[model samples]
Target chain A: MKINNLFVWLKQKPRIAFFMCLPLILMVACLIIYPFFYSIFLATLNKAETKFVGLANFLFLFKRETFWLVVQQSIFFALVAVFFKALIGFIAAHSINELPSKGQRKWRGMLLIPWVIPPALSTLGWWWLFEPTYSALNWLLEKLSVDAIPWLSETFWARFSIILVNIWVGAPFFLIMYLAALKSIPEDLYEAASIDGANYWQKLFFITLPMMKNIISITILFSIIVTFANFDIVRVLTRGGPIDTTHLFATYAFRVGIESGDIPLGAAVSLFMFPVLAVLSFIILRNVRKRTNEV
Target chain B: MADVEIKDLHKIFDRTEAVRGIDLSIKDKEFVILVGPSGCGKSTVLRMIAGLEEVTEGDIYIGDKLVNDIPPKDRDIAMVFQSYALYPHMTVFENMSFGLRLRKFSKEDIKKRVEEAAKVLGISELLKRRPRQLSGGQRQRVAMGRAIVRNPKVFLFDEPLSNLDAKMRGQMRIEIKRVHQHLKTTTIYVTHDQVEAMTLADRVVVMKDGKIEQIGTPDEIYNFPRTGFVAGFIGSPAMNFIPGNIVKNKNGYSVFINKQISFYLDKEKEKKLEGLDGKDVLLGIRPEHINEKKSEDAIEYDVKIDLVEPLGMETMVYFTINKVQLCGRVSPENNLMSNNKATLNFNKNKFHIIDPKTDKVI
Candidate 1:
């Protein structure tokens, strides 16, 4: 009787359940399942022809020397850029939070300016400053009696320029996240710490850092996924130039499929970014869920 | 525990003067309670003593050392906040030992002190639990336990029992009093609840508008409030104030209320009313001062009982005198019924008179 009554009540709320699930069901068919199987089908066969070339795309992916070099470059760029971004962002957030309430709003607004501007527009400015001729940075170095170094034409410098631009574009994200986490902490905890004879350094280590562990982990995870899969800043600033020293997975996919017209190889290279992003996403989501349970 | 002395302490917050220049000396092992209405700066005074607030002027001495420039941690004072402020992430043991750990005490020493405090507070079983896992009364006990573990020079409490329910508040009130009695720390507690102040404080400092209104023992405050505000504020259901004129009647001197109810005064009280016989004076009388079953033995007045508050042991009868509502406690066995007229007598010797202009006791 109880089960029948529950089913009757459920029938009464059919519209609510339907409205809630409409978008998700449609997205599963249109965006997720359809593209997933279709991408696998495209990756297995060679260009427009449905010839079963079993493992050729995977074997050819490893045989290409440029693919391995791009893999190393992407790892180097993402890890270095993420490290600097998270460190600088945490420091900037601490400074902003320490400001008086009235001044804090102005400083936060200024810090968000870089994050608010379009990444492509900002990268265009960086591209202009590192232009081979009439370069502003090289011109300034020459005036200071230093050699006019080729910023974009050199392998290491080109990679370094792209990583720097990524940091500039991404640090504000971490800054905002850390600031939110800092504000969520109650002021009473610090008061209690001070009353416990904890100096500033002791309080930061024992209270602030431990309390911010969840947020710090989630922010770094997000930075990893975004930096690894990033395309705009690298494509605009360096175009994976200087003998492919700065080529990341996203740009490599673009180069092989759009620039070089090797669709199957491009699909294989693009699919390589999935595992790194999936692992990072899983770790971040798990940490976030654990924190929610703790709270 | 040590004595605390504040001399001409003044604190100004922007345009408002929070704690005006005031001097007070609390003796060793004294439990002084600062009691006042909200925004009357009682908490500010307690915070100033805790070194949580900067003194804008004057000096504060904790056991003869001028601690005006000392930070809260170095002042050797522990505070139990109204919200308890227990570290939510730390267990009760950790919360109690945090200060000791920061001062770099030995691990065993911290454990011993925490255990001793938990035993004193009767919370030994709750040491491993975080604050969120504890009940409200338990959290209050943890907060007190944290303070007791420190054994500071003085203890500061900011309305620590306000968050508990009424019955729990009463129980915690007694527990706090017992803790104070055992520890004998020179504690400064702040609360807006006058009942708590009356029951818990060895001496109550009644404040208003950032200034001390009166400082005296609970009996002295209840029996001899120096001002009208103190008299009105210190008592539950408060003392009744009736506007009347002291007149020279045919028999002797008396206070006339309405055209009836002339309360005759004795010679000593009449002499005290010498020059003010015809002046406008307000009479203050406590609820318990009036008796319902009147006789010729005391001065009597006929009143129509408007309402009755039966409190099991006694009953409070509400009546009116000269358009002012007055309440008086009578024995529960009096068979008092609302809307019935009865003769009630005032204990003339205990009557208080205030100057209408200054509201000061005369």
Candidate 2:
């Protein structure tokens, strides 16, 4: 009888709604919540999983020079790549917006090709172009009477190449996002601005950019997170070569934990990204919420 | 302020002709209204004049300069949009000062102009607030203040009061009229509301299907519509049109509405419609022109009231004449009942005779 009553209660509106979402809740628990806590647990364990060393792995990582280098490289890579991506994407979006409607559709579809291609496969294509000896870029340089670049050999060139490839892949995301944001602005605003005696540059500064501020901030924040945690591009292109100078947090964590067979140390290195990302997300989300409330 | 002249202006969007060769010369400091139904190219014509749209094949002159190739920023016009397109991120002061600042005005001048415009629009208290913080009516006032601060050669209003509620629309209409009187800038306003056109315009240009149906004063458009389309478009509850044939009798001419009802033409109407005898035509009379009081110069007919709408000041009586629905406006004191027979009289002087083929006044 109690079981029957429980079933009846479950059939109520709110309970039924909760039950309908039960699958998604459990899926999230297994996929996201479980792995997050499990990583923390693994970070506390010592090598071989026989002993618990509280904060030792973190302290050891902090003492290492390579860990500091990885942190600096990760922050620099994310900031520079995301900045270039956003700039180029905004310019491209404006260009596309200027085209006639039929032409805009054609250009939008063509510009999204870099994004639609799988990152790893396209990164291999970029690797071939950046190959030290038989590089296509070198051939073009020879044709132009310019010196051949040591694209993936030297440390600086390797970092530049990785950032360039990241921008090539990521700029389309910003372009698409900014295009949607641009389209959402009412056309009458531009008309009013023009009739009020605003030139092209004035309209861009006063109308387009101000209206797109919220979306731009949110897109940059999301791209920062994605670019900071990026692994596939670096792994496929540089593999943290040239004395580990281009090693980001993800690549360095993989080298330390999976490749070097020190799971606790690797987990600790990966876990270091949490505080930085959490702070960034908190600040950006607060800004977004404030803007939304104003609107 | 400067006069604007548009000569044979045409806009062809792909295959569809949005504006089919319109020519208009607006006097300096005059308020001209372009009013029509939606998709009638009234807004298109306004945009073309503002330089927001490229003129396909025409010459536009503002003052003495030809502006067909000039960009909108160089056109020296200020426009208030229907959406009140205030910059969402900027404060009201910033929104109003944006145009002046772009024109390289001094800081003190920008501040003075914005403050003055805001005071004129009665939105001085909202100067520091962002557009999102203001109500709809406040935002509309900010939009007007933005235009007022520019002090351009002409002011264009594209249905500026449409987004407001009814009461606010009525109030804003008066405010707009007052602004026009105070500034005396040559203005071109566009709207689909006939009442707005009648109330605000020194000259009302009524358009239909991308062509000007009639351009006249409000009184002329109301009393002497040149076309059937203009007659039907300009009046409230619309002027009732009944298809009929003019019959020439021994004494004079009368219109046979059907077997039951016939209306004799007055001397002036008969002189105007003499050539169209024995031809099918449309007889139009405004709802307000029909009355319950008996008169010597009115045609009396007994009509069965189908519906009665009491609107406090006046009541509308709806009935069918020759199977065509017709409405007559009567004073509320008449207290007419529905589904009952009543004697009605249509003012003979106010009746319109329209040629059926051309849809033009006979």
Candidate 3:
């Protein structure tokens, strides 16, 4: 394992380091670097690829109302969904960590089922649950003498259904991360806090939260990236429909490039996510590094 | 008057009994130590006194009040854990002042108390540093400082020095004793090291297999151990146990080991082995009790040396008596080496005679 450390090898042998880096360099050039530049090149061409229409696709997308809606909803959808996922995941991890080991295992397994199932398959089941006539939730509300609510047919409910499904598929990842972090904390800390006259809430705020801060930041950062470009839930459940209220960047790109047959426009729309992702990663990673250094 | 008393204490984890029927009454200002091997329930007893673990049966009293249901926070006790358990994110000042801050002490009061404890611990300059920045010894001092800052009625230390190196452990042992003398708070320290027990405790409670084997002053424990287990457990290099028989000789009754090794019973020793003539008994000989130089009122035996260990000031010479290995501490000036034929002198009065059947010192 020590032999696999790159920094050690780089410092010890220059020739071997260059030789080792060749495969990765070739991979980036052929698979990643080439594709990224080619996508940018494709974004510059017109729909039929017959004419160079520099800035036209960008100008057009900037002018469209649906493009603006997708932009607003993607940011909203990523932030709100990631926030709820993190909150629910933290609560579940904290609660399950308090249980006996056997019970904790049972609950952890059951909660992870949502994450383990394929997203498209699960989203299909969710779409059926949101059917206008046969939605099981609305049937329960109707039996309770409450008005049946529109799930997929209305814009608000459609966006709500998509965010709910996204959270369901992403929260288990956070639960596993936070739970491992919780277990890694020494039990002596809690015992010391007890002897130091700390109540439960005091221990939580003073000890647990501070110790888990780095893991919390890292998990949220990863969830933000994954949730921002989420596709399966919006595609399968709402089909980016209900007047495009639930159109995340991924689904919007799919509609413009693959479905609507405007490859250049779709490339530009998908390219829009890179800047936002890069900025969010920069901020969260900086905080994480600062916290780690302080520690 | 914050003495600690435990009556009929027991701690059972599932089917394994950790502490069984332990009764200890530590006087106010007394520094009592619980010493034992691993799995001896010494730490369990300490935790029950600190209220970190639930009392499976019976009662614990502090300051004359039964505290069976009291939480550790309300028990008015402070513990220095073995791992130190200093909060990594907080400065040493905050770590030491956490208890007082929890009780709503003013900032100035908290700062004064923390500074005082830090000065006592010689860690005043490390106040701004976090735990990760401190060395093992400094972290240990910070843990002690945290306990001292609380100024609780009782102080509990659970193997606090076991994590340090040998040199650091020795230094911290004296530091702990000095701290105990200064604070004069009723303190209960737990350690598996017999050296720590002997050096630190006003009285040591030796435990084994979830039960107390003996409780006495260090001198009493070392010299007049009532049980064979106590005799074997207290000393370094351990007490060598050799089984021999008492036989009536032409002069009087003597302990004989293959005719080459025998100790003539004096008047006092005769009285000790009265009515047990010709019966089997175990000789408990400490290494220091067996010396190479001759002395008054000691027995001499010639042995073929098996091993020699030079320890600067003294040499531990290993030999055998009738195929049973025995060790003797001698001055290293002789340069005794293995396979040498030497005469070892055994202090007749110093050796203990334990009855083979009862395993009790006679």
DockQ scores for all the models shown?
Answer: 0.62, 0.80, 0.81
lDDT of 3 by residue, A1-295 (tens): 7777865656767777788899999998999789788878888999997789998999999999999999999989989999999999999999999999989989999999999999999988988888897999898998999998899989998888888988899999999999999999999999999999999999999999999988898888888898998998888888898888889999999999999999999999988998988897998878878977875
User: In terms of TM-score, how similar is model 1 to the real structure?
Assistant: 0.93
Per-residue lDDT of model 1, residues A135-220, tens digit only: 99989999999998788889978887888888888999999999998998888678767777888898888788877888888889
Report the candidate with higher TM-score, 2 versus 3.
2
Cα lDDT, model 3, residue B361? 89
* Residue A150, model 3: Cα distance from true site in angstroms: 0.6
* Residue range B1-362, candidate 3, lDDT tens digits: 39998898999998999999998899999999999899999999999888889999989999988999999999999999999999998999999999999999999999999999999989999999999999999999999999999899999999999999999999999999999899999999999999999999999998989989889999999999888988999999999888888888678888876666677777766777778888988989899988877888678888889999999999999998767888899999888889998888888778788897876788
Q: How high is each candidate's TM-score?
A: 0.93, 0.94, 0.93
Clash counts for all predictions: 0, 0, 0
Write candidate 2's Cα lDDT for B1-362 as tens digits: 99999899899998999999898999999999999999999999988888888899988999999999988889888888898988888899999998888889999999999989988999999998998888888998998899899898988899988899999999999999999999999999999999999999999999999889999999999999999999999989999998899998886888888766676766666777777789899999999888797787777889999999999999999999888999999999988999989999888778788997899887
Badly placed stretches (over 4 Å) of model 1 are: A1-15, A24-29, A47-49, A139-149, B248-254, B264-277, B293-297
Among the numbered candidates, top DockQ falls to 3
Cα displacement (angstroms), candidate 1, residue B293, comes to: 4.7
lDDT of 1: 0.88
